[model samples]
Target chain A: MSEIKKDLLYTESHEWLEQQDDGHWRVGITDHAQAQLGELVFVELPGEGDELSQGDACGVVESVKAASDIYAPVGGEVTAINSDLEDSPDLVNTDCYGDGWLFAINVSDESELDELMDADAYTEFVDE
Target chain B: MSEARKTPLYDAHLAAGGQMTEFAGWLLPTRYTELMTEHHAVRRHAGMFDVSHMCIVDITGAEAAAFLRRLLANNIDKLEAPGKALYSCMLNEQGGILDDLIVYWLEADYYRLVVNAATAAKDLHWLQQQSQHFAAGKLQISQRSELALIALQGPEAEAQLLHQLPSLGAQIKALKPFSVLRDDHYCIARTGYTGEDGFEIMLDAAAATTFWQSLLDAGVTPCGLGARDTLRLEAGMSLYGQDMDESVTPLQCGLGWTVAWEPSERAFNGRAALQKQRDDGVAEKVVGLVLDQRNVLRSGYQVFSADDELLGVLTSGTFSPTICKPIGRARVNRNIGNEVMVEIRGKKIPARVVKPVFVRRGQIMPGIET
Candidate 1:
């Protein structure tokens, strides 16, 4: 069983949303997604200032077994990407919800967050 | 889903926390711990693998040697000693590879063959059909499904084996590559696919679990199919179904050296077609590709020439743990140059073409290093 953070918002695609102090949203893959992907060998991050749709493919996470696309949970403009992942991709495996956050974004529409699942709903969604 | 067959070491793999997956109709471990950790254990220390799913067949009678000579691409006459082993490919009538196997001359009238799990039945059928054409004497084929095979591979493989079975250490240590020693209950061979010093031991199925436990207690890491694939790929060893199959010939699959054309009079199965193929020319060849970027290369990726003409496709690809880079084998046009482009996810990435051997005996081979 994987840990589901109670305060975070999640997408059906497994990305998590964290509200940062700057009013922007911090995003990363959930614990369940990283566990299923195994050891991460390479991570392709979206560029800062890039605009993304709610369901757009934002980046890629590749393991020894296969590669998976990371989809945007909400429409936003990328504010900052996790540049540390370029040198060390396994951080996504070690701390998926913390330092492994993929990219931060400035939300274009606050209503998109209301469409996301809360922790309790996400836990049930992933379990199903 | 239909129930998959379990190996004798299935319980042992479960106890070791192996992630079980379906492979060749059998449930087997893909990895016990992490892929790279298990892979490095085989390169630096020692690792054990449960390869019992491989089919073992024993051929006997006065015509055994002659029967093999007619059926296989490699000459079995090379095995002069009792326990000598030879790696050969059983080809179809059209010179396409049926399966690659190791044949051991156990005695004057008996030889043993170990083949891939998925191709065992087909290979056996081909062997039986080909044996009907032999003129020397009667041939007997026995499938030994009662035996379990395990491989202990690495630089310290001998040491670990000696530590476990000390009484047989001296004799096993003296066994050269491609040689075997059989006792009442064990058949230990000095051969492996990981390009390392190792022994592939065959024992009774009933004793497999206990033997695996003992090896585990002796500190030999338990490896799975995941690490095994990476290690063999790094060593340039070809996989049965992926690298070559019924539609692919040895000439195109980088296995031409396994073919024996000697005694020009000897007519092996598919020899005529192979001879004709040799007389004309082979169209494609398998070569190693080292990706310049950090991108992961995978099978079915298209290879292109510098000017954007399609060349061939990758047969086996992986992130090589030992080299810490992405490497793959591709069957491409014979005229392909040193540099080629591999199309991955609609992006054409440049890769360097080189010999298939990236690493051998724990040492990195030349031209593969970044």
Candidate 2:
């Protein structure tokens, strides 16, 4: 089973959100997402100031085997992105939860956060 | 929609941690570890693939050679000696390519052809239909279902075969590229799609697992169709269905060289149509494109001229592992220039057009650089 981080919220589309100290939400795909995609070669990150609604397609991750869209789990304005992915997309496959965080979103609507899944729920969701 | 057929190596691939995926109606591994690793193994070292899914047809009888000469686009007489091999395209009457195949003249009155798996049924029907024009009973064509195929490729392919199957050392050592060496028990061809020095071995279906295990025991990496595709793409080889199908002709797909036109009297299948098309002029042809960008240029992507005219579409495409950039083959206008733009994800990405061949024998061929 792929690792699911506790103390983090996840969407059905597989983005994991970690609440930062500044109330910004750190976003990245879960380990399960990266493993299925396999050997990522490129990632198209959303613009830093782009506004996204909950569950909107925010970016794209392409691997040798397939390509997938990255979805926003909560409504927010993009603040920062893992610029390292521009050169080393494999980080998303190797260290998805740590160094491979995709972008940080400054919250505009906190209610969308309540709809995210916790570790236990996500574990059940993925298994199904 | 029927259940996918499993080759004899199905269980073996699963045992080796292969991630299975359905391809061309066969259940096969997409990869064991990762695709690039398998690709590099074949490039820098050695890799083996379970190619039993490829359909092999055996033909024999007094009229076998005559039958093939009329059935294939290339001249079968080119296989002047026993064990000689010829690559050809089986085309329809309208000059549309049915399939690209490799036929080996094992000996007089006996020939073996390896064709794409997805087109096997239709190809067999077409072969039977075309056999009617000749002396019917004098030509016998049958599928070789009892045999399994293994492709051992790379820089070390010959060395591994010599070391592992030491008994066939003499024949394996003397086997020329595109030729085969066979006895009652084994048929080995020095051919491959990856543009690497390799051997395609055919043996009893019962022995396939044992052969695969022995190759793994010899430390040869296990590769899958995923790597097979990337390797062929980098080598500028075309996939049958993607590059050309019933809707396209060989001349339009960069396979004009495979056609033999020297012997004017030799009227092969689709000869009249191809001759007419050549006379009329081929308006579009397949060319290689290289994009120095992160995103991929997948098949079906549109090509445009610098001034924004529609040129053509990519037939086969992938992110080239050898060059770390996106490279693909597109069927575009005959007047396409050195530079073009490809519409990828709604944006026009500029690309450089070069010769259709990208790599050969594990080395990047000239003109691939952007």
Candidate 3:
């Protein structure tokens, strides 16, 4: 089972967002996402500072078995991208919840997280 | 519907966290642990694969030699030794491959043939039809679906298996490449599709489960079709339906080397056409391609020349764990230009030609022209 940090917020599509005290949120594909995708071969992350709407496609994560789109859990401005993945894409499969974190951002509205699933709820969601 | 086959290690795979999938009518593990992990394990150490779906047919009688000589494209006289196995293609009258098979010469009047499972029924039917063509002696073909097959491959395969079955280890140790030996219970062949030294063991299905468990206990990593495909492709081996089909001749599918044409009078099916192609020319050849970047290339991607001429389409493609690059095989016009591009998602990606066997021993094959 993937370690689901109780303090983080999640989307049904399997991305996790950690809210920072400065009104910004750190983003990364959940451990569940990487496990489902298998070995990561390619990643296409959105440009830094690119504005993303809620549920917008922010990037792509391709594993040997299949390719999946990474959706924004909530509206935000992409402040940073994980450039490390450009050369070491397998990080997504190896450390999906840590160094494999995809991007960070300034949240458009902190209240947007209300629609997101909490860690306990997300676990139940995946189990179903 | 007839029941789908199961490997002897099916329960063991489930226990060891392998994902099962249906392949050639058998419930086999597509991967254990993970595709890349299993792939690397085979290149680095020993990996065991359940290949029980392959059909084993025993042909016996005075006309067995002549029966095979006429039914296959390769000359059978070369298989003079008791344990020698010859890889050959069964061909149609039109020179197209019906199926590729390995024929083991066991005795003067008995031979064992291993064929693809998907084409088992058709191959058997064709063999039966050709058996009737013999006027002098009777030929008999028997299918042994009651047996299970396991392929233990990689650098450590022999040692791992030896650790499991010490008695059989001595018998298999002296087994030469492409040779087979049968004890009271198990038929062992030093043959594999992974381009590694290994054995394909065939034994009664009832004993298969125990045998598989023993190997696992001996530390042989359980592998699946995912690793098998990447391994075979890296070794430059052609898949039956992908690289060649009923409409493609072995000579045109990079398998001409398997056909024996000496003593031209040894007439085999499609011998005339193959000889003609040899004398005239082949129109196409299968070659390997390596993607320029990390982008995943897939089957059906069209190949093009520098001047934008369509050359061929990819037959199989994957991210090679050994090479750490994308590689594939394609049948292209025989004189296809050296430089070609693969059209992926409507964009032409420049690709370099490489002799297959992209990965060997957990490292990318070197000296390939890009």
Candidate 4:
């Protein structure tokens, strides 16, 4: 079965959000998404301070077969991007939920987080 | 568009963690592990791919040679002896490519052709229509739907093959490149899409599972189409739809050598148009491009001259596992110099233009180093 963390919030597009101690929300692709995308060769992420709208196309994840767009699940201002993935894209394959985190954002509206799926809802959604 | 077809090895693939994908109307494995693992396996050791989705065709009769001579751009007479293979482009009347295929002369009156899976139906219809001009009893065209093919490739391919079929050791060892070894069980051809020493084993579809298992038992890593594509792209082999299609001629796509112009007396399909193109000079030709950056160069990317003038469109592109760099083939202006730019996602990245061949037999070519 695909892993779905109980604490982290999920998006239908397969991105996960974890609240940082500093109130910034951390984002990364779920294990299910990484499995579907195969081993990633490259990941283009948003720069720090770039503003994004809900469901806006942000980055691209490219495997050998094809490229897929990464989306911003909720509108926010980009705080920090994962620079490690630039050199080690396969980190997403090995540890998609941990070190493979994409970017952290300072949300314009914290209410947007409630609209996202919880762990049980995302698990059911993925299973379906 | 309809329900995807499955190869005989479908269950075997699924059991091996093969990631399935729909390709050419068949649901085949794209990669069993990851693209890198399978791609490097073929470069360093032995790997096998279930290529049963490709079409296997047999042509026989008294006029088989005559029919093929007129049908293909390459001369069928060049086979010289039985079990010899010839790579030819079946061309339309306008000198456009119908499909690029490999034909093996099985005997005096029979030949075997392996064509691209995507063009199998169209090719069959064209073959059927063209064969009407030949005498009914003199030519017989049949699609060998009951056969299955597997490509065993890499440096250790022969060693692993000998481990399984030790009885045919001498025959397999003596088989030259582009030759076939035939017996009661299989038609083993020393031909492969990857630029590696390998065999394309054709056996009964019913026997596919057993053979696939035995090869696995011999330690041949089961590969999928993802590695197959990257390997062929690094080798600079032209893919049918990506590199050449019905809209392009052989001369325009680095297939001019496949067109047999010698002994000009025999007129093949698209002879007049090809000859006219040769005489009139081809405007664009396929060339190799190597990107120094880490980004991928994909198909449909625009090619530009140093001054940003549009030259042509890229046909095939990929990150080469063997060389660890981005390489691709493009149809650019014939008069182009050594330097060109490829526009990837609106950014023009400078690339070095060179000859198409990148890797062969696991050895990187002289110019492609780095």
> What's the lDDT for all of these models?
0.91, 0.92, 0.84, 0.91
lDDT of 3 by residue, B229-257 (tens): 88988887888988888888887888988
lDDT of 2 by residue, B164-193 (tens): 788989989999999999978789999998
> Model 4 misses residue A53 by how many Å?
1.7
- Once fitted onto the true fold, the runs of candidate 3 whose alpha carbons sit more than 4 angstroms away are A5-12, A17-27, A47-59, A69-79, A103-121, B1-3, B135-137, B168-170, B275-280, B360-366
DockQ leaderboard ranking: 2, 1, 4, 3
Model 2, A1-128: lDDT tens per residue? Answer: 79998999999999999988888989999999998888998899999999998888889999876989999888889999999999899999999999999999998888878898999999999999
Model 1's alpha-carbon lDDT is 0.91
In model 4, how many backbone clashes occur?
0
DockQ of each: 0.63, 0.74, 0.54, 0.61
Error of 1 at A37 (Å): 2.0
Give the per-residue lDDT digits (tens) of candidate 4, residues B99-188.
999999998899999999999999999999999989999999999999999999999999998998899999999999999989998999
The digit string of per-residue lDDT tens for model 1 on B213-280 reads: 99999899999998999999999999999999989879989999999899788788899889889889
iRMS value of model 3? 1.3
Q: Return the clash pairs for model 1, or none.
A: none
Q: How big is the positional error of residue B248 in model 1, measured in Å on the Cα after superposition?
A: 1.0
Cα error of candidate 3 at position B339, Å = 3.4
For candidate 2, what is the DockQ? Answer: 0.74
Cα-based lDDT at residue B29, candidate 3? 81
Error of 1 at A41 (Å): 0.8
